[model samples]
Target: MKHPNDHYYLITFQYLGFRYHGWQRQPHVKTVQGMVEKTVNYVLKDKPFKVLGAGRTDAMVSVNNSAFQLILREEVSIDKFFKALNENLPPDIKALEISKLSDSDSFNIIQDVAEKEYLYYFTYGEKMHPFCAPFMTYVREELDIEKMSEAATHFEGKHDFQRFCESSDSQDDFVRSITTCVLAENTELKANFFPKKSYVLRVVGKGFLRYQIRYMM
Candidate 1:
């Protein structure tokens, strides 16, 4: 064991966001960060440490990758800690890696993140399976895939999307860079109606402001 003063870790992870509230701690809804703290503390048998995340993702928005930092008083083998963590962590949130980060009084992912991506899935015409219930959005009317695809192309590069973003949880700076946004037809896509078209919208960017995907689609 090492002195607690110098010990710290930068934790990287990914999760399925369907089961928990957005990242931040809330009164009622469970949160990803909350679960990580509780499970880690459980591993430590109640040793307390502060859990800090780079950015807080809203509910139903899955994280393909993310980072957080925690300071500790003791040194622990990374492999063993991760093994125990995987055992304690729920199916939704899984620790991908643990690395020591340079000591800094303050850490923020927003400033350091080079790029980020958000994928939104949807199908029109019919429902293929219940498994996609969480990610798939079924539309009552068929959206022109070509038109939508063309619209997506229009979003590439940086643009002021204030007019496009939905009217929920809006904030200043609607300008967002769209490195790539496209609509592609899903094969053999099924829906409530017979023989129809289906498509999924995949958008990648430096970052998304908020509800930007819904507005783009």
Candidate 2:
């Protein structure tokens, strides 16, 4: 339950999750949420506040854009806070936008999310430069790109993805919808260190279970 005096703000940000242990905070491992909360606490000077992520990502999975909800006991200057947050946050994480939400607004980050897109960049047949290891995966054996592209089409549309996710006793619903799934040449992300021939597996959907994408790949 939220107090009547509480203020709500929507914060959009992006981060390189290569070093962090996914988005959620855990007991020992470093996480994006943990780092964000630490910076927020520093910025607010120990003021009472709550942070809720839109969703959780797996370890070493980077995000181009994502958001979270910040609930505070009192309102503060948005511009000042945003500036301070970016200044205090680590280089790998960036705060993009911040907007105050009115009391009449109804926004639940998790429930309200319409869709998400995930991209897996990979290359095969040759060893890649050490610098490329962080952003792309390399397989020693040559891969059949044509066959992989054909197989990707099968993942499209609605289906029971129970086998495509990590086993969980708490989850009862295994049905999920995939809006799009495609394997294509790596045109979206390019670098000099990247191999001449690389591919990307793109998946778009409303929701996904834990380790679902990894299982599918």
lDDT of 1 by residue, 72-145 (tens): 76667888988998899998889888987665546455577777776677777664466666556777675678
Task: Give per-residue lDDT, candidate 2, residue 7.
Answer: 94
Q: lDDT of each structure?
A: 0.76, 0.92
Native-to-model Cα distance after best TM-score fit, residue 87 in candidate 1, in Å: 0.5
Could you tell me which 10 consecutive residues in candidate 2 have the lowest summed lDDT? 101-110
lDDT of 2: 0.92
- Strongest candidate by TM-score: 2
lDDT of 1 at 33: 86
List TM-score per model, in order.
0.82, 0.97
Q: In every candidate, how many clashes are there?
A: 7, 0
lDDT score, candidate 1? 0.76
